[model samples]
Target: MRFSGESGNVTSGIPFGLASALSQAGSVLVAAPVMLDGADLISATFVRSLAGSLSLLLTVVLSTERKAQIRSMPMPIARQVFSSAVIGTGLGMTLQLYAPSGGPVGVVSALTATTPLVILPLIWFFGKAHPPGLAWVGAICAVAGVALIVNAG
Candidate 1:
């Protein structure tokens, strides 16, 4: 791991990745209960959306730089961000909430963890620069890990 040079914080270093993973794991942990008990999935999703929006809103409100960037964002990029936030968060969270409704969390998580594999082909489809060789390795490893977990369970 590289050392931070005073310009990095929660979103930059290994701490960020660790914290992100922990937060994801926590979400999965909490979702287990919601699914198992037949809780209102919509209500849970609402809470999630509200919390995420509020936190991001707070960050932008507190940071003049971020507010300026948002204000000055080009129309195309802003549209992309807005649409992505809507479609991605809406569908992604809804399905994620549904994933644990039928099976073990570990297996579900492992299967859903194929995000890297999904992204690689999308990069290829977009004719973007090919993802690095390490990315392919990581994608393969993610698939293999899922296989191992599913088989073990």
Candidate 2:
């Protein structure tokens, strides 16, 4: 399946970078139980989701500037928001919930780093754009690095 970039524009690494930051923050919370062995995964996930929902709701309810900006956007904005929610908040969260943390940090970190490989190819295929040879080489290196880390674990 083809993937649409943010705001239906070209795929820049910006969205991926933002996703990495957000995922890192969420993983910090998720990894607590793995390291401590007391907290339940369900509880941790509930806390994460609840906190996110509340923050979003609060922003929508309180930020007049943001609300106005959103309101001023075109009708297609709903579609954009819906698409992001479905892919990001829905499927993305499910995957994070299922990713195991019982292994070496390096292994988990390496595996998590493979996202760009899959996404870049999907983006290129969907957009019919070809990246430079170095990009392809880097992608291969990323895969190989992940393999080494996992094997070492």
Best by lDDT: 1
Estimate, for each residue in 1-153, the C-alpha lDDT of model 2 and write its tens digit. Answer: 223323544456567567656766567555645545655656666666666767667857886877987789787778877787667666664455556556544455566667768867765786587766777898999899878767763
Model 2's lDDT to the true fold? 0.65
Q: What is the clash count for each candidate, in the order shown? A: 0, 0
With a 3 Å backbone cut-off (N, CA, C), the pairs that clash in candidate 2 are none
Summarize candidate 1's per-residue lDDT along 14-85 as a digit string, tens digits.
664576567777788888887789988888877777776776698689979879889999999899889978
TM-scores of all models? 0.78, 0.53
Candidate 2: which stretches are off by over 4 Å? Answer: 1-81, 101-105
Model 2: weakest 10-residue lDDT segment is 1-10
RMSD per model, one decimal: 4.4, 6.3
Candidate 1, residue 140: how far the Cα is off, in Å: 1.5
Could you tell me the lDDT of residue 38 within candidate 1? 91
